[model samples]
Target: MSTTADQIAPAHDEHHAPRGLLRWLTTTNHKEIGTLYLVFSLTMFFVGGTMALIIRAELFQPGLQIVEPYFFNQMTTMHALVMIFGAVMPAFVGLANWLIPMMIGAPDMALPRMNNWSFWIMPFAFTLLLSTLFMDGGGPAGGWTLYPPLSLQTGAAFPFVILAIHMMGVSSVMGAINVIATILNLRAPGMTLMRMPLFVWTWLITAYLLIAVMPVLAGAVTMLLTDKYFGTSFFNAAGGGDPVMFQHIFWFFGHPEVYIMILPAFGIVSQIIPTFARKPLFGYASMVYATASIAFLSFIVWGHHMFTVGMPLAGELFFMYATMLIAVPTGVKVFNWMATMWRGSMTFETPMLFAVAFVVLFTIGGFSGLMLAIAPADFQYQDTYFVVAHFHYVLVPGAVFSIMAATYYWLPKWTGHMYDEKLGRLHFWCSAIGVNVLFFPQHFLGLAGMPRRIPDYALQFAGFNMISSIGAFLFGLSQLIFLWVVIKCIRGGEPAPAKPWEGAHGLEWTLPSPAPLHTFQTPPQIDPSEAHG
Candidate 1:
């Protein structure tokens, strides 16, 4: 067998030992903690997805058939918060936990004890959050952005929500620190930064972004809390603070928050495209630079989401152009994917299906985002169903789709069993078509003038809304098929070979299926001669 890191490295201090439950509970084993994080994020994904289903149901016919306006608002706000924080964000961290060591030839994440702490905080934090649903006034109705004044009017749960956000922030900060330490300190002697996988590179950048801006969110929300109880309003004009200032602070954190969700997707797609296509990723150096530029750009464009809240024309124009400028590098990434796929042997396994769909559908979202970048158009598009349509396209098909692709691609390696290919394809098509049906018409409705976040709409919006509702139901149900596929694959299936795909290339692929707990007890012996074979 062609040897990789796990086989070549010598066993280190106790990292390879499989001990008691305390080892799992307190151990720094990257693989164990990574598994825990991924499972937790998936659990939250379903929880948040359920909340989304409720929203889709309420919007089904536009007659306010479900919960009251107050309850509906809580659902929307918490759903976004849950999906972003509990689902998408942590999933990426989970990926980092699982892949970073394998990719970089590290025995385990640096600061393994802290890694355990990071993973453990999330459930308790979200428990604090989910508990708010049963409170006197319902969860935070001010939306996930949690703009103040309206936020101040909400129930006692607001305090709980604030504290949850704080706990989550702390978890994120610790996770980021662990990731940074591992990447900088733990790489094998021969694995230079440039030699690292794109996924690792992208995640390295993302963890830094988290460390930078997450605290701003903490501080802003803390101020909101202080104003509500302490009567010192940072956002209340009556208390001598400006409300718009809240928008400034929130979005300052908000804009980068969006890219934090997407940059890893860029890295994941970069890795998958080249591996499936049997080529080196086109412009790897450029892709790294592009990810950085996008992160840098994120800080300046927070106002794009807040244009309707009233900024001067100069403020609006500065933001509009800055926001639009994101397309250049993003376009570079899309082109790289196409170029990788342009003239190569490719197969449509479950992972490839999801990856390919991610390419097409996520671009559609990007185009909608481009349209939204127009200052004149945004005045109309802000806070409408079109915005909803745009992000879902990017996120569901973008980040979430990429995550699914990563799962299917690597499940064989993780579980040592090949997933059902036919079932996988079926899952892809059902989800692809269902997502479009669910959200595509939303673009039309928003263009035809339908506001988002309202319980009801006028009669003219009825037909399309009904169609979207049906689509939402199907989309929701199709995911169960996905759940079934994952469960079946993990429990039993045909065994998978090391380097399962002929076209696959990477350090991780060199390891056996069902990778051992301490396989990379020491770094692999690398030689340029052996790589070509």
Candidate 2:
């Protein structure tokens, strides 16, 4: 039963990848590592999603029903940590591992061993973080921000959380470094930086963001550890330290961290929109500048997140204006996507459906973010479900939708089989409807005065909470269909052609379907006209 892929191999597969358990443990193949990262991220997605379901179940009714209050808090805390660290970040890294070398016309990553180590470090780190739940006092319940005083109250679990975070940071930094080096050094003869795909460009910038902010996060957490155990009082009020200082520092890294999660997503949507729209991306050079502009603005806008803290009027105005300025570049992106689709031969495949939804829905999220940017308005929105709704809108639909789009766009190439399109659309509808139903209610609930991260709420807020919970359940179940689609495609279907999507253009697509274990061993020559600018 050896398949067709076995009958045809790319130039670099002169030596076959080893098979079985030892292969995964000992190998340095980028594709294998990418598969590992993707699989692991999906597992973590379910794990994190289950935690979210538990929280929603508890909030389904007015009072506590499913879990104890302490455990509920732990669920909320662990859910965010898992989704951000375990799920989202790893998924992007996985995409990078799979596509970067191929797109850049390189045999493999420049620092292959470091890439392997970076991914391997994740399991141990998350294991340590998750194991904290079994400790005497439960997991870190101070929210993912790990703010002081409340953060210091996590009993035996605090130190472990800090260590886990530090380890994850190390893994991120390593992955970022590998990406930077590989892209800088490994392009083919004519594949200049400006001509590289948007996905690669976005990742190049994202790696720098990671390298810059991960260490700041490590330092922030380490300082928190010292404040808790070593009595350093970096954030201790009694020791003449301002807790607000931690807010300043945390958001400094935190704002860029938000971009870190979404920038690759921007890259993804940029790639998909054009392919489905049957056009070269509009305003290619402006798109690059816009992405770079957004990254640079990310550093200055950290203060927007903390406008509710008692800052001076000048500081408030500066942060508010700076935050709003991000809309300019972001608007450039949204407009370019629209322009790309304006007059083109458009097809609404599953990936396009999601990308289209991302543009509209993610724009809603961005709008809400702008509203939150106003220092005066933030007073009303801060700490409310509005803030929760704002971010989930961005991350879930914004980042998660792009990931779905990428999965569908590339799955055929990855597996050499076409996924069920009918089922794919079904999954998209369920997700699109479910996501709106889930978060859209929260905006109303927040404006009506429901605070976030609460275990229980008053009867006044009960209806929307119930609606949100039902939506959460539906949305959660929809992902099972995605899992089925992925597995079914991987097992086999109609064999895919080398370039399954007719309009698709990239170095990777030039290779065989289910791209060979080794690709671009002898860097391909790129024609200046054929490549992107």
Candidate 3:
């Protein structure tokens, strides 16, 4: 067989290694590191999912039935921490590690050893985090936001939690640096910034966001640790420190952290929608601009989350307007997706199904966010189930569904095997239906005055809460189907062609299925016409 220019030439290869577990432990190969990230993210997904299930099960009947209230709080807190830091962020990084070099025709990530270090650091951090469940005072129950006063009360687990968060931040910063360097320095000849894939473009922006915000988070947590142990007054009320100041610092990082999780999803959806729709992505340049706009807007909109913090009228108005401005760029993205699908020869592949669901559902989340952005309206919605519903919609279906879509869209390329189509569709329906069942009713609960982070709810809010729990369980269990599909594809299946999706475009498709361990060792010729816009 004649090897394509995009594929690594086996005949002249000197980097080949004998297979063993040690290869994974010490390997600097980008593909191996990327695989490690992905597998680790999957494991954390299940671990976090278990915590979520515990939370839902306890909430299933309104009163404290399954776990103690303190333990329940731990479950809620740990679930958010695990999912955000351990599952979602790492999963996106995994995708970036695997796909960025492939899409850009680079040989590997710019710093291959750092890529392995970034992936390896996560397991130890999570192990320390999970170990807290069995600690003296239970895990940090003040919630994942780790607001100072309550966070200081977390007993032995407080320092451990802080250390875990610091570890995660370090890993994230290292990963971000690697991504920024890779995208900026490693593109093949003729691959200008404008010609990069949306996924690549989004990751470039996301890496910058990560580098910017992860350190802010680290600083915030470090201050908390000091206030607790080192007796610093950063957030100490007795020492003349204002707790609200902590809110200001945390949300500054928190809001951008939200974008960090979703922007890559935007990139993934941008990639998948065009492929199954049999069209080039509509307004490709606009998509890139919109992503950057959203990132810029993210930094300014942090105050919206703190609308109830009693800022002056001027401050409130400024935040409200800034928050509303985000909708414009976000609307551009939504319209572009719709335009991409407008009258194109669309097919309802599993990936397309997830991508379309992402547009509709993420928009729903965005609308609710806009509603919350109104400083006046937020007074009513603050700390309620409605607030919970808003983010879950965005994260679960929004960020996570996009991940599933990308997996389906690219798994063939990654594994050289065709996944079961019927099974894939079944997983989609379950996730779509189950997620709605899970989070949609939380809106009703929040509006009806049910507070979040409490183990028990009032008798009045029973019905919708029950419905939400049922949805949560269904949504939680349905993920097992996804796990099965991934494993089955990896082990064996019908062989996949290099271009598994007929409409797919990119240098990635130019390489053979289950892309060789090394690709683009000699930079592939970058033809402008062949690149996805």
Q: Per-residue alpha-carbon lDDT of model 1 for 408-439, expressed as tens digits?
A: 88889888999988888898999999998999
Report the C-alpha lDDT of model 3 over 255-283, residue by residue, as the tens digit: 99999999999999999999989999999
Give all TM-scores, in the order shown: 0.95, 0.97, 0.97
Query: Could you give me the TM-score of model 3 versus the true structure?
Result: 0.97
The candidate with the higher lDDT, 2 or 3, is 3
What does candidate 2's lDDT look like per residue over 67-100, in tens digits? Answer: 9988988998999999999999999999999998
Q: What is the lDDT of residue 19 in candidate 3?
A: 56
Order of the predicted models by TM-score, top scorer first: 3, 2, 1
After the best TM-score superposition of candidate 2, give how far the Cα of residue 503 lies from its true spot, in angstroms. 0.7
Could you tell me which 10 consecutive residues in candidate 1 have the lowest summed lDDT?
1-10
Better of 1 and 2 by lDDT: 2
Worst 10 residues of 2 by lDDT: 1-10
Q: lDDT of all the models against the reference?
A: 0.85, 0.90, 0.91
lDDT of 2: 0.90
TM-score head-to-head 1 vs 2, winner: 2
Lowest lDDT sum, 10 consecutive residues, model 3, at 1-10
Please report how far candidate 2 places residue 413 from its true position, in Å. Answer: 1.3
